[model samples]
Target: MLSYELFFKEGLYNAEFIKKFTIDFDLLESQVEPYTPEYASMITGLSADDIVTTAREYATSSGSMIAYTLGITEHHCGVNNVFDIANLALLTGNIGKQGTGIMPLRGQNNVQGAGDMGCLPNQLAGGMSLANDEFRARYEKEWGVKLNPYPDDTQTRTFDRLEMGELKALYVIGENPLLADVHMNHTKTLFEKLDLLIVQDIFLTETAQMADVVLPARSWGEVDGTYTNTDRRIQRVRKAVEPHPNTKEDWEILCDLATLMGYPMHYHNSKEIWNEVRKLAWEIYGGITYDRLEEEYSIHYPCPDENHPGTFILHERFHKQNPDIKKSRFVPVDYTEPLELPDPEYPFMLTTGRRYESYNTHSQTRFYAAGIKVKQTEETIDIHPEDACSLGIQDGEMVQVTSRRGELLVKVKITEQVVPGLVFMSFHWSETPTNVLTLNEYDPISGTAEYKACAVAITKVS
Candidate 1:
């Protein structure tokens, strides 16, 4: 809505970069015109003046950055939200330089590493597209095996396939989906329907307990490997302590399983596997060898060759190096209401998030005595005092929270932290099982569940 006023009238945006690199600027302007500050205020509850001020400050600032976490991505319109955020950066040219860009904070330490190593359903190492013929061919030749041209089902779709009896076996590693996934009751049912379930982890989590075969794996402190941090820095992780007598590293377990299944993986150590990765995804991990890391300690990726310096800021010289390659495109997206909204039946909107005291599903943090004693001993719902009064519920009183999918009992903490019509819960306790009350709705493109927003009804337990 303020694009013309800010970009043209006030001259706040980067006109030169936009004209050269970005496409569909005029279309994006038109698309966003309907979404005025007033319209946004009605949805977000922030004043129009505040919105305009924030926009002006963000656009006119010398350097601005936007960092978001799962709160933004765990929504039904998660992809659209990301596209719009990119549109903001593209509009103001808040990218391709120091102290300017969008960053998605990963939930776990190795989440970035996992994605970079092609852990997604439709990606090769270094985030190369599996559908791309050249990328697929390169991997197939290196591994000496035929690669699947088609993309596999996402986790959300895998559950659906399992429920329909299309998928028979599931091999899970380090994930406690029974407590982490939305609609917990449904997830449990789907797991029961699977013909075979194999779980590999350092801890016997709720999901592992149900697995037909459980493989004990070494923890992070006992593993020797490199971790690609959120900043794209590939740093080595050394063994800090000896692993359990029977436990093995995750890679070792996988290799042994593969050997038993007729495909032998003769990787001697983690470094050998890392060498293979450097050979395959040379463009990203090529220059980041273990030897170089031993000297430098850490280095950012896009280190294509041995002599090349590591990249600190991404796309800093992309347009300068290759004028033909447009830096990025503007994707205009409009706001959409959440999949499940508060109604007469479910009068409160419940959002789920993580607490500092406990990690997701309490898989590891539950073992920490300090974390348990310091804060978040158990799961509790946060509700506004007004809502508590209206419902005849007191602070610290046990209450039953129900959603369309399932229900759970949790203690309430009445405070002004949440609005009258909204509540908050952390999904770190298996006893409470917060995901049981969450909706199964997901974004079509990303397949991320609406864990951030769901409709629920809260009442005092009798």
Candidate 2:
């Protein structure tokens, strides 16, 4: 994570390298590994002794940088998933190696940039903590705007207020919240009550269809910009096509909107925007330019100059005392049961995710030379083999999935990809619309909805 400004607290981050509690081998009755058996057997229904033995075996295994994406996160206990991985990294002390580190993959190409720019609820632009007066002062000095000292930059509340009809207007850009977000009905209900809804997109999306104003926008191909990938790669995107005459690139689009909103937004080109982002938040992202990026296809950000070789592995000296002092936090976890466990009425816990073929949602890929058809939509309720046999259902058979939020008819894909107690489906579904079945409950800290866990019942249909 390239941050132009923010820094981490030290002692908060440490491996069990330093002794804390007295270790009693006699008292060490239980052994646990992360994700696997040593997994929290108490809460996760895993075998404690078995996982401990297996974790011993797992520790001996070696490989390249272990990178995990949404497969690890997007869970009821997503934070634990990260905590465990970080612990595993600290155990082996996999810092400052060429092909080592706990690589928690990101959801988007520009997620790092967004993180740097402080799109999060808690931080300010340039990675400054919203609570820190010093960080706020730095931004105030740079922008010359009397920014609010209070720490209240909550997008979760903005969406929540929109749902409650407390917020009259909502502007969304390059994102399809309808299919992309969990609890589809709740979002629709809230958006329905809104006096005005604005959606800016390269293509007409399901969310755009419901918007009061759908502003056409240029795609990455028709735009010149820089996208920082999960690996902190700073790459350039050139304009391969014209900005569709009517639609403009994101930078121009933002500037025009800001100008109309009485903010003096000005930028001649994409390079200028990058320069501004660098200027505002120089600690993490310093003296870097398109000309420097053009020298190579991509290089990691924080390179700071044309002369610097990129840093792929971070935190060798940084994580230690009196150095960079940026040790990754090791948060020991206590597992909690998912909100909705399997019951008689709702006999299965439903979880949602993305498929390799589809991107965010179906709208982009649904229409082909043939047409958009329900059968073309590849969403299926992933049922365990035992569950399918017990429910008297076969693979490819249609099933009625009912959840607390709503219900939908979806095909059943009987497989052992997931555990027996849980069922899986992709949020990418539009016709089946998996989000319709998801609950509105979200992570209190991240405001990330618990899209992964909801009570669902599957009955053989059609």
Candidate 3:
């Protein structure tokens, strides 16, 4: 906004108040290591005084739009980052507007749909808040499946159980979790322990290498479907060409699997499945149909009737009422240090992130620099100029970093963006796997790992 502080102009809220935080910034209480002004130091390398001043300006601003990608989500504090984002949005009242919202730039084409359709470990379709029973009952009635009453929200999510001899069968769809998730050694070990590993992908991915059954799947080019994008656009996509031999659409594959599993999912085609989805879906998809889509050419959901137009923006006025009003609680979140901190044994905090050159874990492509094959793909750590000079290192110098789990040799990129005693790396390569060196500990609330903070010993290798 034109105002000095964006959040204040828009009446948004921020959690930063009176706290000592950290020297580098710990966001702690006067004595507590957690939830202080030093918390600013946790995210930025500024001094405590500087952090307090900057945070005051930011938190008290009129309106602010939080922008984040894999860098925010791939860490152990990933859930906290998401929660923090939401908290900021709610606190500042920046949501329900044109210029401000917690924007999670989506990775793939259909992730939002998958999340909206309830493809997460928790919740049902339409991004229905999992704790709601009315939503659960609706799904049970629509699909005739006995729904689990409790939400399966786990921040430290792991299929590692499947590899650690805990879980049995696996039914993977388009996801290449083996390459996509952290801890390659652990993930591969988990894949090895599975009794059944079924992979369905347009191309045979690295994860598919260990699968017992590989089902050839149709690509987006050969499918007619509706994809939801980051901007909440429900756009239509038509089939452009025929899929290769023995390949079929994911809907057909799912229907077949359902039939085999003793649930008769008898759908003729993609259109048939979409029809059923629209009929049972209550909120946004109440009025959408393949017939209507064909006639109107394209339409967003929440139209409710043939005459009604699709929705573009979510926050207008009365329609944006808070449905979570029963025992709605505004939490006063105090900041906390990451679960793992660097000590004498490990003198640095090694944080892992992604690169803008390509997507996260997109390791099998030619353009990607796998294991130093390409310059952009090489493993590099972000450190401050002071820390780099103290360690007798320069930019692009090979360094050995050892964490509790494992180690990797990488080049260094010195920057002052991060606080001293903290370091960062990218988890995008297959050969130079970052997860091997990352702690598996997760947030108790979200099951997301504390990938942002891991104690490690960093030394110049050459």
Candidate achieving the largest lDDT: 1
2 against 3, candidate with superior TM-score: 2
Model 2 per-residue lDDT tens digits across residues 1-462: 111011011122223432231122121112232333333465556676655644444344453356888756666566676666665555444545566677767866788877766667577865667778776777778667777766653555788777566779888888889888878888888788888889999888888999999888887778887877777787888889666688877668788888898877888897887787677656556646677778777877566555676666675453444532433444545456778777899989887877765677866665555653443357888888999999899989998999888999988888888888789888776777888888777666556677778898888885
For candidate 1, write residues 302-379 as lDDT tens digits: 898899789988977534646678457788777788889999999999999988878888989888864346566898
The C-alpha TM-scores of every prediction are 0.96, 0.84, 0.77
| Candidate-wise lDDT, in order | 0.86, 0.69, 0.66
Cand. 1 TM to true fold: 0.96
For this target, which candidate reaches the highest TM-score against the unseen true structure? 1
State the displacement of the C-alpha of residue 221, model 3, in Å, after optimal TM-score superposition: 3.0
Root-mean-square deviation (CA) per prediction: 1.9, 6.4, 6.6
**Candidates ranked by TM-score:** 1, 2, 3
**Candidate 3 residue lDDT tens string, 20-128:** 1102112211222243445555455556666556545656566567777766665555666676666555544555566667778866766777777777766666666
